[model samples]
Target: MDLSCFKAYDLRGRVPDQLNPVLAEKIGRAYVEITGAKKVIVGYDIRLSSPDIAEALSSGLMAAGADVFDIGLCGTEQVYFATSHYKMDGGIMVTASHNPKDHNGMKMVGPESRPISSDNGLNEIRDRVLEPFGDAPQQGRYEPLEVMSAYVDHLLGYIDAGSLSPLTIVCNAGNGGAGLVIDELEQHLPFEFVKVHHQPDGHFPNGVPNPILPENRAATADAVIAEGAAMGIAWDGDYDRCFFFDENGRFIEGYYIVGLLADQFLRKTGGGKVIHDPRLTWNTMDLVKAAGGEAIESKTGHAFIKQRMRDEDAVYGGEMSAHHYFRDFAYCDSGMIPWLLVAERLCQSGQTLSSLIDARIEAYPASGEINRTIDDPPKVIAAIEAKYSVGAKSVSHVDGVSIEFDDWRFNLRMSNTEPVVRLNVESRADIPLMEEKTEELLAEMQRLNEER
Candidate 1:
């Protein structure tokens, strides 16, 4: 087994070279051993190699004396739903999730759809896979189940069907697993869906399913304007993260969406705790506080966020990367629920998406996360800290280095999954100052790179 395939949160690597059937089988056996799970659920995405990997994983699980339920052709979140909904012991979703075409991986969860990160049980499974183990004396059973209708029902439970307006929504699935769920949910709703790249194409003819990149965003934005739709939504490859665009076809930043969703959740629950990542803070803090809720900051990453939400008894949690977690939804992030809640907000408020977010965006102009590749990430980070920490209002290292001043602030952190440093800058309703400070930080990073 190639150890590099195991990541901080999940398993992801190039096909055959790093991840394949044999290693997947080993992972399956190791997971059963570590969790001591008697029953497990397995699922796959639209990737070309997903079915084979899922089959291998199921075989290994069955060989380990664990009953396996195969839920075919589903998104990552669907596995989460099935694991918790069916009261299964554990689950795994075969997906690369917004990675390039030639890559594949797995997202694992324990009972109740709780995450299995490196800190909890991922590293143990990784180590066990490297050792030798024989099959059990007797094999377990395998069963097939259909979860689409039930999954759609669970999704619709988040919002009232009668309250939704008859608005046209542009849905760009990016040829991933999201189209199937969207189509299923459309039958139960009153809204008109203008589908784009709706088919599940493993080859990704349109492009990779990641809408966070500017190159992949144009199709969704263009479709929204051309269709004269109320709003546009796009999802990643496995559809665990969803992005939104306004009626004017402008791509709304996920930072403001976090605030918006936090506010909505607070309103629904009256008063509760909301968890947010440390990258961008002011907007979420302001919104949560104003809504009579407590705001908690956790380190970035899904594992950390979910754990913090559980610990704090938070009603909702959100990351600037468009991952939203809910207490009602097993404390797991859902790509499907955020848009539905947003749609409900629009319908009940009788306001366009732009109008709803305009004030928040204006009040806190931000530079959506900028990434830079440097030879020495630590040195550059240290340099940034040393330079900016003098006479600063405060400095914190919860996830990375975040420095604050009176009106402007920025957070610089190394990427957990990629080899780049992410920088995010924001100011109090000052776009010019945000741009200037962003450029200044970039120049400093460049200088440090040159010195290296």
Candidate 2:
């Protein structure tokens, strides 16, 4: 068995080559050994390879003397919800998220929906896969279950529209698993919305259905504008993250959405605490602090943010990547929550999405996260630190490397799963300085790449 399936956040790779039935079986045995659990709930997305991978994973789990409750055809979060909702001993979701259709991945959740990344038990699983393990455990069995409806119901529990007013929204499912959730939710929720490419086409005919790309957003934005919808919401393959389009079909950056969600949660929870990734906004921190809540900044990535939330007991957490976590939802990010909150806010205020975000952009202008190809990310980071460390109020190596000045700051870091350096620069109304500093950083990264 090969170990290439092990990735930064989850077990992911191209199907049948890097990730095959044999490797998945070994992973199941290893996961059971690591967790010492007897019962596991398994789920999968609507990918062409998902069902086969799900079967292989179940075989491994059952081989390890674990009873596998196979919850067919679901998203990663549904598995998370199942782990706690049904009191399952553990769970696994087979998905590659927004990756190409050829790619597939697995995300695991321990009891109570605790995530297990490579740092936790994925490495051990990888090791076991490399060296095929001991005899299969005894009494392993398989059971089938359907939890999609239950999962949708659980999501709706957080958003009740009894006294809510309605408006038009354009929902773009991107031909991913989100279509199922949106389809069900629309049946119960009274809202006039246009849906584009809501079918679950495993091939992802329209270019992987990822909302992050301008090309992928075109259909959704066009639908929103053509239908005269209030706003547009587009989700990634698994619906783990969501992006928005304003009434004018302009794509609203995720950073502002994070701040908006933070504001909403802070208002409701009376401002306990909110956490955000450093990649995008200090405006989130400002909003959290302004709401009389404490703001905690953590590194990018869902695992890092979730861990920080657990440590801080934060009421909410968000990232510029569009992942929004909630305290009520076990501190895990949900693509579903943001839309509900947005709808509720719109109903309550009778304001459009653009109107709500106008003041936020003015207050905390951002450069948006920029990525550059680099050979030696560490060397580039060192060079940037050496050049800009002067008069730096403070420095943190938390995620990548972040340096702060009195009025502005920047975070330059390498991608954990790729060969590139990510740069995010923000300032106190100094767009020119931000651009200049960004240029300096990009030049350094290019210089380092050439040197390498």
Candidate 3:
């Protein structure tokens, strides 16, 4: 197996060349051996190669003396749900998420849907896969498990269906795996949905299914305005992350959604702990604190966030990248729950999505996240840290280098999945200051890149 296929958090690489059925089977056997999980759940997305990879993985698991429950043709979160919902020993989803069509991978979880990251156990699995190992003493069993009905019921349990209004919602699945869940959930709710790119096409006829990129967002936004919908939502290929847009067809930054969802969850539970990534902080911190909830700062990435949420027993955790984690969901990130909770909030509060987030947007004006490709990310980061640390009121390395002064702050970090450096800047209700600082940082990064 190519070591590059193993990422910091999950397995993702170009298909066939780096990740395929042969390697996937090896990974499956290695996972069972490393974790000693007896009963495992397996699922796949709409990717053309997913079914084959999932089948190979299950075969390997069964060969390793583990009972395999196949939950065929589902999203990544469904595997997470089934793992904990059925009390399975472990689970694996054969998905490449929003990666390009030529790429594929897997997301693995241990008991209770807890993530299997490099820091936890992925490295051990990697090493074991590379070494030689014989088959188990006895072959295990394989069975099919239907989890759609139960999954839908659990999603509706997050919000009162009676509280939702007869509002029109625009849902763009990006021709990924999200359409299946959306179609199922629509039957249990009263919202009028305008579906765009709704079919599950492994070819991704619409695009790569990543709504974070500006090029991939127009469909959802246009549909929201064209259909006069209350709000618009879009998800990645595997449907583990969802993005939101307002009724006016304006794409809302995921940072404000974090604050909105944090406030709602805090209010719903009467007060609890909330976890947020360091990339964007002020708004989440302020909203969480105001709701009488303890706000905890965690490193970015789903694995780190989920572990921190479990450690803090946090009611909710959100990353500006559109991943939302719930304590009740076994500390796993769910793309479905965030929209449901937000829709319920809009209904109960009798406010448009715009109004609900406008105040927070003004209060903590921010530059949503800016990514810059540089020759040497470390050198640029060091330069930024050295240039700003002197006058900064405080500095933190929880995930990246975050420096703050009285009125403004920014977090600069290199991307784990890409060669770009990401910068997020925010200020106390000053849009101009935020913009100025963002430009200043970009200029410095560009200068460093030229020097390199």
What range of 10 consecutive residues in model 3 has the weakest lDDT sum? 1-10
Order of models, best lDDT first: 1, 3, 2
TM-score of 3: 0.97
lDDT of each: 0.93, 0.84, 0.92
Give me the runs in candidate 2 sitting further than 4 Å from their true place: 132-137
Q: Write the per-residue lDDT of candidate 3 for residues 16-116, one digit (tens) a residue.
A: 98988888888889999999999999999888888888999998898889999999999999999999999999999999898899888999999999999
Report residue 169 deviation for candidate 1 (angstroms). 0.3
Models 1 onward score TM values of 0.98, 0.95, 0.97
**Model 1 — which ten-residue stretch has the worst lDDT?**
156-165
Cα deviation at 347, candidate 2, in Å, is: 1.2
Residues 1-452, candidate 1: write the lDDT tens digits: 57788998999999999999999999999999999998999999999999999999999899888999999999988899999999999999999999898999999999999999898999999999999989988898999989888888899988877888899999999999999998888888888999999999999999989999989888989999999999999999899999999999999999999999999888889999999998999999999999999999899999999999989999999999999999988899999999999999999899999998999988889999999998999999999999999999999999889999999999999999889999999999998999999999999999999993
List RMSD in Å for every model shown. 1.2, 1.8, 1.3
